[model samples]
Target: QNTTSFGLTPCPKWNPNGTTIAGNSSGLKGNDTSSLDRPIGIFVDVSDNNALYVADHENSRLMKFNRSQHQDQGEAIVPSGIISAESVFLDREKSIYVAGGGKVMKVIVSGVGETILDGETEGEIGFHELSMTLYGIVVDSNDSLYISDGSYHRVVKWEKNSTNGTLIAGVTGEYGDDSTHLDFPHGIYVDFDYDALYVADINNNRIQRFHPIGNLTGETVAGGNGHGNGLGQF
Candidate 1:
């Protein structure tokens, strides 16, 4: 059986901070325009003990919850400002970053959502594809974003304060052949310690990695062909 609860700190909410789990207990109601029915996840605000934020993707909004304060204090930080968000990241300064619609956008705590990076959104970059859809997004300590262009079969880096993106992975025009190129790149995670990147190459049914500076790339740290519903098994 599946059991869940919304509270200051609850089970299966992933990580628990000093206080609340950071979720909205208010169920859907009549005339509720915002898409609160499907909440993705709750993000904690490190600045304040009681402050927590939830990504209401369908509603295209981000709202904050403060445990010390009553439900009345709940407020939408960025309202109706996102479209089909797949992943979200919160920086140390409480800045919320969202990746969707083949682009990554930033919403400062002041409530302004601006298209920060996108090859198709801004001027054409090194390789622009109107069909490329972005999956996972992550920002390095340098504030540069790493994204997977699924349609192009590779990954690229969108440096901070630059409209142009340099190709970090070869657009080999194939998916999961295990050759000298990538296939259907999906999710990406930056390994700061080793200056490397891990990617979920979906179509290839595996995960791969590349050095931060490139030229030193490798194959799935865990070997599998995308058979299991969870992590790959040897």
Candidate 2:
């Protein structure tokens, strides 16, 4: 299944790396110390001259790998919970973003992960308290960011340097049509080449595509009925 030693969801996707797609899922398990998590989610940092950063959240650290000489070689650059992280995200500048414990943190190369969108991001967006789970994040070329608020059952979009997210899809919990329907949405990806938006509607067992902007009122990418295998026609 997985070519790498392991795999992780909520992937730390890169900005269209050349060949390989580097990322990890999670190393989290229970409250106990032993059953804790493992290192998951690594990204190929071609932007940083082909480097790697692993969000080993459960073990409480981050791993940086040198891809030039050893593609698989790495070192834990930052310790876990150093940025109050649960998930890791890397921007174009090789800056890392981690979302965990109601916060999304940003980590610079020379410095640490300062809180970029957390307490204030929540307050401004009015999505903090209302939503229980927030996962599935994707960014366009310009810096526009989108996040899937699982608990509240909505997909929200926020332009860079903006505080609040404009609700663009699933504005209400009333699930009926393909456009305005989503439940427990997991992974969201944007096909920049086609200006298409792909969403892993987990609960719905399908993937949906929308225009560059959030307008889910059209045809579906995968379908509204069942899970997809990534090799079929619309």
Candidate 3:
């Protein structure tokens, strides 16, 4: 149940003159050559903000936008090969990482798509052998991806071209209100300059940080005394 409506509307300053762009009042979902449905992930091209890439999840495609030319709509870069795309990350080489459907896919700027990790295998580029709720991916400067798993309550780090990931944070199969555990971790960020990872522990009502490296040992940097509006709360 999506209580509220969803649509891709232009930001205020982007088009100050208020010209029409992609999408309509009706949240219609469709593939390339049509409107988007349940679009989730979006990334602005580093060199060109007008050129935005979107993970058209339900459409199983990636859409690219040229604000100057395609303000009315975006064009599909990869016409197929994506599933339930939840998040998208741009690498240094301009490739995109799509996270969803129990797999992490790499979409080259040239529109080639390949699977980097899935839940089944064990040898390399495989998630742990268990049901995984993958979300919140952050790519480090070295092209390493740090992903969070809400189902297993842990974070895994997969190096570029690696066969498997190293569990870096959280306790597997455990959820608690302590520094050693995380409850429904969401939204991860990596600070390459400082060598730290930050996680939003949603259910725990706090944010945690793993410094130097993700060693599963986290320190509460904010919100510990439960959700609230006062200082040092929520």
Give, for candidate 2, the lowest lDDT window spanning 10 residues.
19-28
Cα error of candidate 1 at position 177, Å: 3.1
Query: For model 3, how does the per-residue alpha-carbon lDDT over 55-81 read when each residue is reduced to its tens digit?
Result: 777777767778756565677666666
Backbone clashes in candidate 1 total 3
Off by over 4 Å in 2: 1-42, 47-52, 57-61, 67-74, 82-86, 119-132, 172-177, 227-234
Top model number, lDDT: 3
What's the TM-score of each model vs. the native? 0.66, 0.64, 0.74
Q: Give the best candidate by TM-score.
A: 3
TM-score sort, best first:
3, 1, 2
Candidate 1 lDDT tens digits, 1-234: 011234665534555535323343355521132225355545555557747666565666666677566553456666665555545667765677776566677988687788777555454334543233666666676787767777777777777897666677645344545544777676777776776778777666676777764643556676455556665542
Q: What count of clashes does model 3 give?
A: 3
Provide the lDDT at 51 for model 1: 71
lDDT of 2 by residue, 141-169 (tens): 56666666665567777666776667656
> Whole-model Cα lDDT per candidate?
0.61, 0.56, 0.70
